[model samples]
Target: MKEIVIIGAGYGGLRTVELLSGNKSFDITLIDKNPYHYMQTEAYGYIAGRFDMSDIAIDLQGLIHGLGPNVTFIRDEAVQIDETAKVIILKEQRLSFDIAVIAVGAKTNFFSFIEGAREHTNGVKNMQRVFEFRQAFEHRLYAKLQNSQNSLNRAGDLHIAIAGAGLSGVEIAAEMAFTLQRYHKIHSEKSQRLEFSLIDAADTILPGMDPYIIKKTEERLHELGIKIYTKAFIEKIQERSITFKDGTILPFDFIIYTAGVKGADLIHTLDTPKNRQDQIIPDETLRLQGSKDIFCIGDCTEIKDAKKVLLPPTAQVAEKSAAYVARSITRLSEEKSLEPFHANVDGVFVALGGKYALGILFKKIRVKGYFAYLLKKLISRSYRFGLEIKVNAGYKKRHVGSHDTLCR
Candidate 1:
């Protein structure tokens, strides 16, 4: 049997396994730092307590068991890729592979625009970071309630600034606005007012998305009292304060860097052509530009569109690329030619909190308000369930939340 090793259990790697695991001719081992697969789309929602943490994770072991005996799961982090020997260097051991697929997803990137940003700020990219921010948020607020109930500016009012007006940034800002408002209404005595801001270097938010969608999103953010700062570059992040390029300092209780993302660090170790974002440049067939046997997919690779422009890294892009890569691998075994990976996006969907949302479907249909929110939920559910190719043995739909201390 030929040994096939896949790295990273994000949507891309996970779906690739589902498509190829049924083949008895191949022995597949999936390696990921975490044993569970997380639904990254809902990561921000979980931080805001809109979704359960457990609901967002899928047990990899359980996923493999249902796939068949041909697939295995390894809970380990990938450190390097020794392309010369065709082996993956893990934290503990080196594994050789006849065919290697690198799908290690993106990481939160604080570009050079902000100095000391990643060190001082927080984000909702993963569960751990979200939990940390929630703890710090409540701890700071509770401390104020106990010490300064009579202080000005709502005692411990928080000034939250989300860097970058992308989808994640906008979603986080909107959800926080809703959650903070809800919290104050419940605990009027100990509550603190929250100030929300979305700062971006670009003049427009969600630049590539339809104008109607962007307009609707701006309106919703306004209604939710979220301030928008466009064409403003964050020059520095120092001790709960953000300084713009103009030397204006804005004090914030917490800062989140949704400004950008770069590919997994492992990609830099490979001798492959990469873009500015550290994303491996993949050929039309979804293979690394230099190697035919080594495949790269998901957020880790930059695959351009028909217009020769790089496509955005989204779950849909990852899933579609995964499918194409799997098909290519199968074709390789059969000595058939591989086809190019094409992306066909439905449109953009923005959840603006509190029974409100905005979306553009099929690049034509405009959806907004409560109807858009429901549609977003429906689309999310459909994608999650559709990807579950294996029967989960130990995976339970349990609820693990944040902000428990504040509720008490």
Candidate 2:
């Protein structure tokens, strides 16, 4: 039996396990620092309190246990991969594997040039940080309410700035704007006015996205009272203010940095060919260059398409590459020829607060407003449902000897 070791429990890693667990010839060991899978794509909603813990986090222990005895789930951190030795170095132990997959995902990039950016700004990349930010925001609102009831003089407008007007920044700014407005209406008290700003150095928000999407998103942000600051390069980030290149110092009550991301720190330690972002440059078959048994997928790998353009490290790309890698591994075990992976993006949906969204399907079909939001929610629900079904089916097959029966 092949001893397969997969690192990280993100979308890619989990999907790979789901596809390969049914194979009787493989023993799968899935390792991750966290015991649950975080739905990072829904981070905006989660931060806005639109989703609870159960909506965004799936218990890895329960899911893996349901996959049968052939699979093992380890809640440990993977620090490095000894490529020459075919071993993974974890914080607690060293693991040897017949085959290895690196899907450790990405980390937020706080550019070194920006002074105090790392120290002053918060991020929504992980659940802990998200929870902290949400709590702090709520406390700030409550404080304002208390001050109003006491008839104390208002300090100033409560400014919340989102640095980097990419997909994450846009979604977060929109959600916060809507939520803050709702909070104001509910309180109906004279409190500190709330102001939101979306800052980016790029010429436009959501750079490299379709022009129509950019236009529509800008419109919605404006409607929701969000200020967009494009081409306003940030030079420094102070404790309560950010300095722009043009000598503009903007003060804020809070700031979120969603400007950029790079491959996880572990990826940089490996002596493998990688792109500028430190993402491994995998071959057409999604294997590490010059290595046959080691594969790289998800945000840790920089994959290009037939046109030689790098694919964005979105969940869609991660899952597609993961599925391909799983199939390639199966073919390798069977001594069959492997096929090259072709990347394709079927659609994209961006929620713009409340029940509004913007989407593009098949690169041509555009959707907006409530229907797009509903579509996005349905897609997210479908993914969760599919995972539950796969786990239940695997458990039933292991105990009842029947693959058709799915245990609820």
Candidate 3:
């Protein structure tokens, strides 16, 4: 049997396994830095006390354990991939494979435009930071405010500055606004102070969103008592104060950075075509531009077409890429013709506070409220079930033979 190794057990990597698992022709190994696959969409809800941790996290082991003897799941980081040697080097061992799939995702990009910004801000890259920020918001910041001796002290106000105005930034600001207001209301009854500010570089929040949706989101955030600062750029980010372009300084108790994302730094080491953002440049077939045995997908790759550019960073794009990859790989292994990987965006969904959401469906149909929320949940469930089916099918076919052979 030939060996196949996949990196990063996020949507793309895991889906590839689901498609190829249980094939006796190839041995599969899935590697990731973390043990659990985190659902990025619901992470803010978990942080805002609206949802539990388990809702956004699933054990990678549990998913693969059901895949039986055909697939092996390892908890390790891919330090480097040597295309020449056809091997992957981990911290503890090296994996030699006939084909390798790279799907290591991107990380939050601070841009380093503002000095001390990276150090001073709370990031929403993973689940831990979200909870950590929430903990600080609730316990530390509130405690500092409540115990202040001077009523005129700046600490009592507890200003929060969110650095970016993109989708993640907007969503976080809205959630924080709503949650903090509820927190303040409960605490103020017993006499405690709280305040917040959401700042963005653009003149308005949600830079590219439709005017109606943007206005609605802004209104809702304002209703929660969160101040919005438009057309503001941070010149300096200090430990306690953020200085803007016009020399205005604002003191902040917490700063959340949701500005942008860059491809994983590790991908820079690979001898593949890379974009300015350091994302792998893949051909129409989703294979690394020059390499036949190697494939690249997800946020780590840039998808190009004849007339227009495309973004391959979202979970939706990653999931679709994985499906395309599965079919392509199967055809290649079976010595069949290959097809070009074309991206068809089904929809785009952004969640606001609580059950509120704003979305543009396939036909540009705008959606919000309970129906959009329910659709989001169903999409998540479908993803989980799809993964489960692939693993289970592989295990069922290999279990008895492997068990009986081991006993003999």
- Best model per lDDT: 2
Candidate 1 residue-wise lDDT, 283-376, digit = tens? 7777777677889998989877767767788988898888888888888888899877887776778888877888888878888888998998
Regions of model 3 farther than 4 Å from truth: 141-155, 189-193, 210-212, 304-307, 384-408
Per-model lDDT: 0.80, 0.88, 0.76
Q: lDDT at 141 for candidate 2?
A: 76
Q: Which candidate comes out best when scored by TM-score?
A: 2
lDDT score at residue 343, model 2, on the 0-100 scale: 91
Ranking by lDDT: 2, 1, 3
> TM-score of predicted model 2?
0.94
lDDT of 3 by residue, 1-408 (tens): 778888988878888887888577878898888888877766667766776777777777667766656778888888888888999998878989888889888887776678887888877876688878878766874565466534544444557788887777777777766776676666443344556677888889877666767887787777767788889988888888989999999998778887677777668788878887788888778888777878888888886434455553688888788888878877878989888887777777767776677777874788777787777778877876766665465466456444322111
**Candidate 2: clashing pairs of residues:** none
Candidate 2 per-residue lDDT over residues 221-253, each given as its tens digit:
999999999999999999899999889999999
Task: Spell out the clash pairs found in candidate 1.
Answer: none
How many clashes show up per model? 0, 0, 0
lDDT, model 1: 0.80
